[model samples]
Target: MNYFNYKRRLSSETRIGDIPLGGTNPIRIQSMTNTNTNDTEASAEQVIRIVEAGADYVRLTAQGVREAENLRNIKEVVRSKGYKTPLIADIHFNPRAAEAAARIVEKVRINPGNFVDRVKTFENFEYTDEEYALEIEKIRAKLIPLLNICKEHKTAIRIGVNHGSLSDRIMSRYGDTPEGMVESCMEFLRICVEEGFSDIVISMKTSNTVVMSQAVRLLVQCMDKEGLSFPLHLGVTEAGDGEDGRIKSAVGIGSLLADGLGDTIRVSLSEDPEYEIPVARKLVAYIKERENHPEIVAEAYAGYSPFDTSRRETYAVENIGGENQPTVISDRSNGNFELNSHFLPDYIYVGKELPLAAPRAIPSIIDVEGWKNGKNTYPLFTSVNYKEIKGNAATIKFLRLSYAELTEEVLSLLKEDTTIVVILTTSHVNGVGEQRAFIHTLMNNNCKTPVVFNRGYKENETEDLQIKAAADFGTLFLDGFGNGIMLQNEGSIALKSIDAYMFGILQASRVRTSKTEYISCPSCGRTLFDLQTTVALVKEATSHLKHLKIGVMGCIVNGPGEMADADYGYVGAEKGKISLYKKKNLIEKNIPSGEAVQRLVQLIKDNGDWVEPDNN
Candidate 1:
């Protein structure tokens, strides 16, 4: 795939029931049921709801052969009710269940991490070359049966790899990195090809958006080198509920989709499965608009690496770059600047006039004409006026320039000025690519001035703005391209909403964190308690802890391993019990579900990681 061009990665078409995916097919949206698979009535009903909500496919967890067999009953019920949407059986650590489901459902998803290899113990062990070859043979021996089953039944297969659930064998070789994740899937894909089974889909998921995006991109690169092209299934596993989940999903999944990678997508949320479809649909619709986007003419930067998260090196101009966290610049150019919320922006761009009562601590950006030599105020000059103000510029100045404006002369001038921070903007339809091109130019020219992305949105809904901005800005941040972000909306959305989302984009990108990050999984049949309700209780109790990451998983299937980056974990242990974890290590086992939240809180306190919520 061309990094600066808009072209979907073409893959062989794979038929899943009546809906075909990849190749020339439209991107498909899917969701999974949280109801117990054995409770066929509830599971079937949820699947119908998801289908009605615009899901092209629905999946249910098949932990054992019993649940796998029950999938046939669920499919029968849905078929009887007139919903012909393709059904996918989600299998983890159970080849028998995958074999059973492959014969019953339209598709079967098996995690390559544990389908054959043992569950991850995170224990490091050495693997000799011959030993590793033996392990691959083991995988081939186990996976061939499932591939034959799939081919015989005409059922598609998804070799899903999760970052948190990488096998001990893979970790021993690749150390739980993107390379390991890609190799995990490739090992299975190669086996499928050897078996002449071509009906397959692929996914690389993680709660960490950075790792998730990187792994998927790396997977594509590896696949291209070997000439394999299976349809991609995109998602950010364990993305928590509400706006955060939406933003995080968009950041991870949208980044890949923007690169023309995903063939099918699911917006995983800690809510009813049906609710995820609309968000997934909205995300797909947002990216689809770029399919025919105007051409972006640029060469890939020689210094840029697409597969890693290395911030583009730049000197700090004030606190906007270098070692500082990525700053947020609120566009209050309409003059409604009021620092009313806890989520404060590091800078405010007020266009021409600084708000009379604007706080002095938060720097303000003004048009070059209105910029006075005052404390905490900076001038924003366009390419045309930058030279004129260069001599009399403030100690810290903002230069607004598009990719086309970064001429040789401007590059030379920027290299000489240590005080200027470039505010990068783009009018092109492929704004992310254009802005990225601008950064690459600066990097190649050896300019150390910090560049802040300035994107303007008009007449868009709040959710649309969130998804779009996160995709655009989050993509750059993930690629290590920006030092700050300026989100400008001329729509009717509140400034506070925009402020919150700006921080959200930063947090989702893993560049900055201004609030508590939750890595809660979308509940499935294996979930032990009321996941939705439990997440709410956990959030309400722990939301004040801004510097922490908490994982609320419904069951052990998505337990410690899935929430690998989380500082604390609340995993379901039994029907009415919960397991609390300090990182990946078990803290307390099987606490009653009713007391899990308080117990988790007490666990945080016990570890001295808790702080009293400020009532002020």
Candidate 2:
């Protein structure tokens, strides 16, 4: 069987400084400097460090004309140090700054949400089609000068779109959706085309993984229709630090990369910028690894549309799907461990047939041949033998079907048992896509049986297991193909680690939110205080606030825009002060850093978002 081949998306190659993006170039890695742009020495030093850490391109926030003008000194300093890595001026709401940076840096990125319009002014007005055209004309008129400057300086431009920051004009028409995100970019893209500027890249970013993924796909589809093949820059904006952040970034960015969609990628973690490069590299390396796998030829029909959210219709099997949150399945199916509530799985597949007592009340799935007359467990039947087993009084049963063994008989057998939940597996190359195709077949045939996505890996190395399993399972979860996830390795990884990864993937995909989310940015020279230490302190103080999102920013430049999704924000306001926000509303400013955490707790408590840590 031939495997699914990832043919890179065709895009116009654009050069940034000495670096090239799109076309046949290897997918590039990018990171932004958190430093103040006016601090030329600090900014240049951070850029060199980012380059040393393997960033192909570095971006600096240019909020005003001074920072934009300072790019000259920053560029000179880095060049004097012999670092030719492309420096991009990140501009928002200021066309003049973009103009200045265009002449100074290799590339300039402007947000379409605010380049010409006053953002977050909360203006609401219904624009007629003519009014909309006039708005575009205004934006085009404002953009032409910067476009000309970029063209003259041979600078590339990235028209990045954020889901949270869509202009009121776009919101009135498109309602803050993936369609709106694409249109936001299209508005600018059309101007670039009209101005005869082809050196362009684009991004559709959001903290929400699903929206980010959907928006990017829609952008590609829409751009394709307009005959535009600009390169894509992919990232999950303001993804928080730690494993949760990593998993979320991987799922969103990796899913698209697997489909061969991204040209340059940045893993936006609330950690040091250098820390992001390694994660991005790991994801990019998976593309090469996929190419080396054995090819499996199969009809591609993932039951769900990758471009749109169409969750498969599944009948409720107790607590698995139909209304319940997606369940997590862990296996002691191959090893011996004491099952306790701390590491409890919703369901378990028994590894050995020994009737050993467990530490808690948990359901188990017993193999057909190993089944007893009155065992208090569900039976697991393979595709070939599932039809032979007599239906039991048990309300639920397990029917395991491998894609390699699926056939007309299996499909027919699957349809006959509404009580049987299908456990879908694939031992083929491109397993994720294969499993997706299997689900697609089931849905096409109108089979509504809930699916449990199951995969086993031979690698016991924890990091490798986590990344590979995440790439395989994350894409499926994002596409809405599974009701539950069951993962196994050669028994090398800890049960608790696997458990964490399972929930982490589910949480990161936004299918479930199980913990407090932090949106921290990588510290840069622009940061007024110690970001790494500050984030650590914030997490330590607020980690127990489950499902609450907190943004810890080093400075205000990109902080406000990046942390748009955070429920509350703790941002550095000045050299020794912090600002607090209640969902983008500034509530306190210039609070001494010494008292910020304690004061934040009080604020959370006042807003009824605080909960005492569990002590039981």
Candidate 3:
């Protein structure tokens, strides 16, 4: 709870090139170009497009000396065109490449894990002190030159830490966690400070939104306690495509930004990096606007679902447990309504349910028939005005049923007293002459009793009335948006689907291993082995083994380092064989790729002494 009240602010006086980053400046939005670095022309074209699209800063991954070689040309291309926007060189696995980029780009991103390993770059430095001092000296020998070059060129440097590429030493000590991530970054930041450079920016990105959020929270808190501060670039790394990614990014980034936390953001997507620009801009804009509103309260609760995930009705209703919903009216300019101790459902008041028009099948926003202007067809969401409703007890109806049997079954489930029901149709006859005769007839014939006890709409949404009604009628707002309701008696909403699988895999991070937990990372275009299938098979075959941690990583390059603390980890180091590790130390093994999963799983089970249950 020490961190609950901790309020560490980033240096408002910091700068990222010509764009001021901290010190009461506007929070920035950033994105990376995926164009092959080898293509200077193509990369330059994308940079110009990205600049025109409102990206504050653009990053280009410099894979090696050849890629770093394009830095000067790419800069010339942008600069010759009079584009002065800052360019960041994302240097991973090689500090020498970073050193080369330091002379050209406005910013350089270096992964500390890979940077420290190239001690040969700093072989000229000698120290008679212990290994720690020697390591620090060597680290400085390599980084100081790059820092000096950046300083001489008036460039800025940001240390970007992806949890997927964390250090082996840190992972071995703290486990792969938010705290471990913070520790790793701090070690790098300390070096940055020790070298007498405070003009620094830092980032911590994870595929898990929750961990990303929590990591920022811990970083700000821990640094505040230690009286160290830096501008933190926030992002949910590898967040997938379209609606789910957008929602998850919003919930994770929005929640923290709401608390006055981030300086810049990137929403990593699976496809076209260009798509990331608009989303990042909108995310920053939305959070900034929300900060000025007085009615929004500090989030004092948890299990916050930003979108509907429940596939069944019983699960959702059971979670509400008949809580009174605060009525949030869209009209707040005049403060016309004073909420006393009295509360109701978000929309309905007294005994009435609020009316919500359902979303109907319409033209797909992205027009899935094909891509736009000869682009591939992807799903996009059209805007809706429902966000104007500011109450928890809003009554939403899912209409335009496709099948009569499903509709009847859904109706049977909705009739329960789990929440107050309203059968009233769209009849204006209440205050005016109502004429919903056709819809009324259908409702009456479908049920022995009225589906909704009462229904009405006031100008638009009656926030006070709806909130009071939902509270009075045993209804509550759900964390997610959905067409159908869930009736569940448990807490955490279980996720399903490929998207949910990744989200759930990330969610497993919070489940503190009372024992062993299985961990795995997704393979990217660079993966040499069949990491995805191997991970699935390992998880499937060894899922019954409890109270132990097992990790299936794609390559030893970044995998062994990230999963250093796993009781056992299977890492593909070569095409035909893998290297096994028992909590940071590599165990003796040369299992062929064919039998890796079975051998790995069996070793884990035997190590943990897991016994299969007998079935009679």
Candidate 4:
């Protein structure tokens, strides 16, 4: 299979500076500078560092004309220092800044949510269809000058649509949904087409991975209906730091990339911009590898819309579904029964022929050739033998079903045995979809058998294997499907690592919370302190606080806004100063940087949100 042709939907090629996108070009990696744009030296230095760290493009925030005017100087300084990385001006609610920056930078990004909505007010009034048409004309008139400037300068444009920032008009009409995000970008995209400007890259971003992925899919679908194939830039906006961030980004961006979507990707981490490049490289490389693999192209079920989620209704199977959290099963077979404290799985499954005995305390699933009583475990029977073992009287019975080989008669057994929990396994090209199709079949027949999704992999590298497994399982979980997960790795990767990954995927999917959640922003020039060090310190102090969400932001831009969903917030106000927030309310202001973390701990204590770390 040709790598470019396999499963990929190609878009028209567009040029930004020296590099091109879409067509056969590699998926580009990009990062934005957080420094104050008016500080040319600092901005230029940050851009250089980002480029050196392997980013193909660099973006700078242009909030006003002063910062926009300084772009020329920054570009000159960067070029003089021998960096040719493309520069992008990130414009929000400043069309004049966009116009000025377009003349100097290779690209200009405008948020359609705020580009022409000058009043910045939220309203809830019904508008007639004719009035809506007039509103579009009025907004387009305001955007014409920026479009003209871009067309004249050959500067590419990215119509970036954010889920949280959709305009009041869009919200009132579409109700802050994926459809709203798509419509927000489409409104501007149509205007660009009318102005004869085709050098455009479009993006749909959200902190919610499901919404982000769905919005991008819908954008592509709507664009396809109109015969428009603009290149797509993919990112999960405000994806927090560390393991959680990586898994969430992989699930969102990687899922789309798997389907041959995305012309470029940016893994938005709450770390340094330089740190984002490697993760992006790894993800893009994986997609390229999959492109060459024969199993990459799988048919999607037309009945199942990629733009929406429908979790299969399932009854509880002993704390596995319904009101309980999704369970994790470990493959503790292969004669290895030494359970490690770090990798505690909910259940363990052992093969029938294995000689190792089940541990007394740990719950186990034992595969039996014939009906035999096992200690501290339940018998796992095959679909063909389910009827034979129906009278086994075990509290929980597991029936393993092959996705490719499942039959209606086997499914009919569920009606006879309500205690039988089905574990769906697949050896098909599209394992995820195959498993999903099984659930669809069950739902169509109104069979409410609780299904546990299982996948087997044989990769040696831990990170690569984690990425693969996370993508396979995380996508389904995002759609509110699956009652549990079972992973079987053939390699010698640490069992503890797999354990961490399974829980990490679950936590990232927002299905469960096992540790403190950090919504840290990727630091830029605008950051007031050493963001990496501060984040590490905070994590060290709060890692034991289960279910707590703490936001560690570098600046005010994404701090108050992105962390609005967090339980508590730590935002930088200025050099050597920090602000503390409880939910969205400011509880404390301008504390010295050295004392901020302690104050945050005390604040948590005051709110009765603190707990002594298990070993702090």
Best by lDDT: 1
Best by TM-score: 1
Worst 10 residues of 3 by lDDT: 358-367
Listed in order, each prediction's TM-score against the native is: 0.98, 0.92, 0.54, 0.87
TM-score for model 4? 0.87
Clashes of each: 0, 16, 48, 6
Cα lDDT listed for each candidate: 0.89, 0.81, 0.52, 0.80
Better of 2 and 3 by lDDT: 2
Task: Give the alpha carbon lDDT tens digit for every residue of 1-616 in model 2.
Answer: 1115455677889988788999988899999988778888888888998899999999999888999999999999999988889999888889998998899899999998888877654456799999999999999899999889988999999998977678889988997689989999999999899999999999999888888889998888888889888999999877777777788788888788777789999988777688888888888887656665555555555444667676777888888768778878777766455544443678777744536753236777777677654444767888667775555656677888877777888788678777778888887666776787787778778878889999988876665666677777888888887898888777567777887788778877777776787877666655778877888888889988876989888776556655767889998899989999888688999999999989998999999988898766
By summed lDDT, the worst window of 10 consecutive residues in model 2 runs over: 1-10
Name the lDDT of candidate 1.
0.89
Expressed as tens digits, the lDDT of each residue in 114-165 for candidate 1 is 8987767878899999999999999988899988888889999998998888
The RMSD of every model to the true structure, in order and in angstroms, is 1.4, 2.8, 16.6, 3.9
Q: How many backbone clashes can be found in candidate 1? A: 0
